[model samples]
Target: MTPGLRLRTAREGRGLTLERVARATRVNTRVLEAIEQDDVRAIPPRPYGRGIVRAYAAEVGLDSDAAVAEFFAQFAPVPEPVRPAPPAAPRPVRFRPAIDRRWATVMIVVIIAVAAATVVIAVGRRVLERRSEPPAVATTGVSAPTPAATVGTAAPSATPAPPPSSGVIVVLEATRPAWVAASVDGRRALYRTLKAGEREQLKGTDAVRVRVGDAGAVRWQVNGRPPQAMGRSGEVRTAIVTPSTAGSTN
Candidate 1:
């Protein structure tokens, strides 16, 4: 039986009026009426509407699970037709130009000569400068006094520390365009229209579940975690990410 019908029948069987059920369940009378009448338009999308129906069913002593199942079944999506695959074509071989033998040898010789000249000039300049420097002497104009050589100690090395472990920020875009309820690690995150690039933050261990219509659902975990098939409303595409730990300069 449909959820609306089941709800209606359960209420009537219990000898309860719509207003009585509404008041007890804290659901609006209009919404309750809609559920009984199978007017799904009156309720919001699942799991928002699902919560309302569940709440109403619980109050009326109806089987909430059965009602929800029926509701989803009624709205369950139709499967798309599959298309035949196209025939694969053989890949064309690519050819690259080979170097001219004579020019290649000349180029190598020229490069070697240039490099050797540069090295010799650099070393010659350094040796000339060292030979030209005068030896250290006492400040007073007299016989040069030899100063005792002091042993120099090396300074401590300063190494940069590694960044702290700040968890990921995932931006999940819904493959199917629809209103969706997204959850991270089983927490009620948000119920909003799943636009492209919609983002959410989750710890490294958290799993992601997106319910896309009554037809499509997908599950993927953050940081190489296993994938799970979630209840579908529509198609879902997941992207893993690590958020920046640095504070914004702005």
Candidate 2:
């Protein structure tokens, strides 16, 4: 049965009033009524909505986890049709003239001759200058020890910091327009439609819950692994990714 119907039936069977449930759960009466009616727009956005539903289910003596799972499952977005890509256009050709072989050879020979002459002149000047210098007379004396060069002293090394709690990272890219919602460590991180070629990154230590309207339209990488296909075109997919299941396709 739908979560709303189940909740309503349970409430009626137990002879509980909306006001009574609201007072106990600390939720508004109108919000409680909206939950029983399964009105998505009237309900608050997640993770608030998820928490509210879970609390209500628990108050009604139902399995909170199952109720929350089934409640969100009924609201998965419908997939859109995929379109074919357009054809590519052709390119134009261009022409160029060739150089004269004889002219090219003469230019190369001139450059080589000039370079060789310059090198020879430089070496001859250096040799002449060295030969022209006067020789130094030999003399020796005891010299005092030189003081050690003084630079800044070293400081003690600090302890290395601990790693972040986030053990995994997820990158989502849209190849085509699609709707996506994600939660990191039970907190809502993303909730909006993505344009083609757009990308987002999410990190979580415990879990990253994701729901995609068009599974085939989005490419994803977990913990910097290679991008993997999610599902067939127009398929809806929902999954909770943890450190162990970060890179696995399943």
Candidate 3:
């Protein structure tokens, strides 16, 4: 039997409907139906189609690895044998719009500005001390020095230090393939498709916001607290999520 038939038979043996399986897996109902009917050609490109099959198999308590392997055996493209062609340099892999890259750049500029200001303050203090002293204060005689204006630095304080940092932390887990756009502290952070089982963590001193292609497919956690739902199934929605916003937006 084909891999599709095996999946169909297994699902039927447990007397479950395609809709029930789709709901549990967060996969589309039509995709689940097509898989069971052995009409997965309707799923378009083979790679994403295979991902759907793998996720579905796992959700149904099937041997996911074995099912995926069998699906690959039936559909995987055969690689072309190497020939005497010109050598090509390896391409760099890129994750587009990576949030941390921009975040690091902003932090570097702030640090440089702080260092420059500190240097200017230190140099000015030294110049002022040289100009203020009297020329007669450097007398060679052994007589007890007249009290030329004296300067004293204050002693360091013995106060307790405060905590290092504090901020809102946002976590998002994608149960299915969905388009996601996120911003942390009003700056664009992530804008791309989140594949199944993907997770993102964001920290912001102000706030975090997100929009999802399918709101129900994502689960969220804020500020190290308990997990909460995002929105209704298959709903395209945008929400202003922060430490305070916990419930789904339906």
Candidate 4:
């Protein structure tokens, strides 16, 4: 059976009303009704519609994963046949000349000699000009000394330092009817219900504590570490927590 049909049957079997299922799932009553009747038009787009259906099924004590899988099975499109591979690409061909390689070597040596001569001539002209010209005399009584050569004494250039790394932004929302509280670096964050597509940002340098119902508590470190347990609640809850570094920004 389809996921919507299965969900509806399970809900009815439990003697639960659409309104009761909606309240438990935190989804709209109309959406619950639409899923029960298999009215795809009433729900939002794909993934979102499937998520709502899953949430609703879970709330009504139905097999959520099975319902979701069935939902996709009923709605997902079939794959088309794979096309044949194209023909192999043509190989590149290289060509070599019959001329003597020594001639090419001689030409390269001549070019280098000409370039060195040009540089030597330029330096000689600058040196001769300085030697031929007389030094200027100062108008003041004191003679002005020639400045010392600046070779190998270049001034150090200033470079700007790089900015500190920014912390990650984690948005967490509940998928079921449950209260959620988050703590980052020992700071209490606001807790709220998980809407169908709600998001919240949590920032921290150390580990972050996320408490769901009395049965669910998961701690996440921002540095890609495994989740640790702080405590737990008795409902479906999710938390987005990021670890912070010493140089991380607030």
What is the lDDT ranking, best to worst?
Answer: 2, 3, 4, 1
lDDT tens per residue, model 2, 103-145: 5556677667767777787687767644443332334656656
lDDT of 4 by residue, 157-181 (tens): 5465585455544445443343456
Give the top-scoring candidate (lDDT).
2
Give the TM-score of each candidate.
0.34, 0.35, 0.35, 0.33
TM-score of 2: 0.35
Question: What lDDT does model 1 reach?
Answer: 0.55
Off by over 4 Å in 4: 78-90, 93-250
Clashing pairs in 2: none
Q: How does model 3 score by TM-score?
A: 0.35
Q: Please, what are the lDDT tens digits per residue for candidate 3 over residues 1-250?
A: 9888888888888888888888787667766776776774545344555667888888767998898788667755758954333323333446466855765566677666666766776687657643442222222535544444546855454466584345667788998777678888668998777888999988886567777767787887876667766887666567665433432222
Candidate 3 Cα outliers beyond 4 Å, as residue runs: 44-47, 76-84, 87-192, 195-250
lDDT for each candidate structure: 0.55, 0.74, 0.68, 0.56
Better of 2 and 3 by TM-score: 2
- Candidate 4 at 13: error in angstroms? 1.3
Best-fitting candidate, measured by TM-score?
2
lDDT of 1 at 61: 86
